[model samples]
Target: MVERQEQAASDAVMTRIGQSVMLHHAGDREEARGRLLDLWTEIGEDGDPLHRCTLAHYMADTQDDPADELAWDLRALSAAEELTADRPAGHEDASAARALYPSLHLNLAADYAKLGRREAARTHLRRARTAAAALDTDTYGAGIRTAIRRLETRLGENDPDDPRSGPPRQRS
Candidate 1:
């Protein structure tokens, strides 16, 4: 069926995205971005949401500009939202599509934080937490939760009223 063929193509794109992520992790950031950009050109902005989500999510990490990073992360989030809306439960791609949401939101929070958008960062962080709750406590879920905790700590440190920001200053 057409759906199965589409799934196959989407899965191939995800595999390529994974390879690009590996390249980025291996310190070939620009090369990784180049590969992803090629994939994006092939997939187009309105292509399979699963492919777009995976590509954009990893693409954000390769960006040198905070604003560009935020843009890619936002794209990933948008694709994820579309995937959730379009994928029906029990559909072949539904589980795989749904699994991207928590990390997509988490990346958005990080991107917003990088751009000093505190309120936006906090909002996306909360969304990430909510999405994470639906994930089973496997390796992926644990990693997402850890990233959320780390980002929360970083955000709290910048807030003067946060108890975890450290003890109050002693009188001079």
Candidate 2:
């Protein structure tokens, strides 16, 4: 069992990390990205792959350079795959990973489309739709649904094609 002293130290470390994350989120993209990279390195491969995956997604979205975006995607996808493999079956992390897989696939498909890999893009898009449909209130559920709807709409397939694709949500 971990000693109380050690546990407390770990808690302190996490608290500091959490504070840093909050600061970043509070109107500081440059600071946030810098801090995120530092935290990403500090946490290493052991902390949270999904966290890294999310960070990578943000990085990819913000990177103006195509090559850098691709690099971020590869890094995020690698982390997600590795973490998912290490997690036990039916574990919450694994379940979350399953739910998030569609977004990764969708992003990959977009990249493939940009690269003119039509076949690969189509294959991944199909996987993304399937995974998104299987999701149930995952953190990425709404995003997945939105993305899937957008993709379908692009192919001339959103059922209503209304301003709001799905039912309304409580305004945050």
Candidate 3:
């Protein structure tokens, strides 16, 4: 009964968050972030890590500096790591939670690049690629492809003549 009640509460939270997402997509960032913060507070400490990570990302995206973005990305990555660690050994493939790792890598890479840490940026890009490869193919496969392409573009290894938009992916 308690589990069901908790699930219901979670559902309500997700519903409200979905509304916030809609607001965010419509350019009402301030409103969305405000609602998001309210929801974050409601979720409490033991709430879902994914939601927390998402809130962090949203907070950063709505911020000014790219370093602020990196901060949120790092927090999300830490949450993903914690989620992975908490999973039992047998079902160690709790990938939906871990998908945040690659995003963190990408964000960190971008930050390093902005700060002129070329080697560090490349290293972070590679780390992102590695994290992406470990993701579940059935779900995050497309995201992994996107991340690889983005990393390739960042590394300047991509051909300028390539038709690809954002990133160039070297398919394995």
Q: Each prediction's TM-score against the native?
A: 0.84, 0.64, 0.72
lDDT of each: 0.83, 0.67, 0.70
Model 3: weakest 10-residue lDDT segment is: 157-166
Residue-wise C-alpha lDDT for candidate 1, range 1-172, written one tens digit per residue: 9999977876788889999999999999999999999999999988987788878888988999989998998898788778778878766556776787788888888888988898899888888878888998899899987788789788762333445546644434
- What would the per-residue lDDT of candidate 2 be over residues 55-150, giving only the tens digit for each residue? 676556555566666677777778778778989868775676676678877886677666666666667677777777787776568878777677
Which scores better on TM-score, 2 or 3? 3
Q: What is the per-residue lDDT of model 3 for residues 82-169, given as tens digits with 9 covering 90 to 100?
A: 7678776454334656666777777778777877777888887777777776776765667665866776676665533446653565
Off by over 4 Å in 2: 1-28, 45-48, 137-140, 155-172
lDDT ranking from best to worst? 1, 3, 2
TM-score of candidate 3 to 2 decimals? 0.72
For candidate 1, give the lDDT.
Answer: 0.83
Q: In candidate 1, what residue range of length 10 has the lowest lDDT sum? A: 157-166
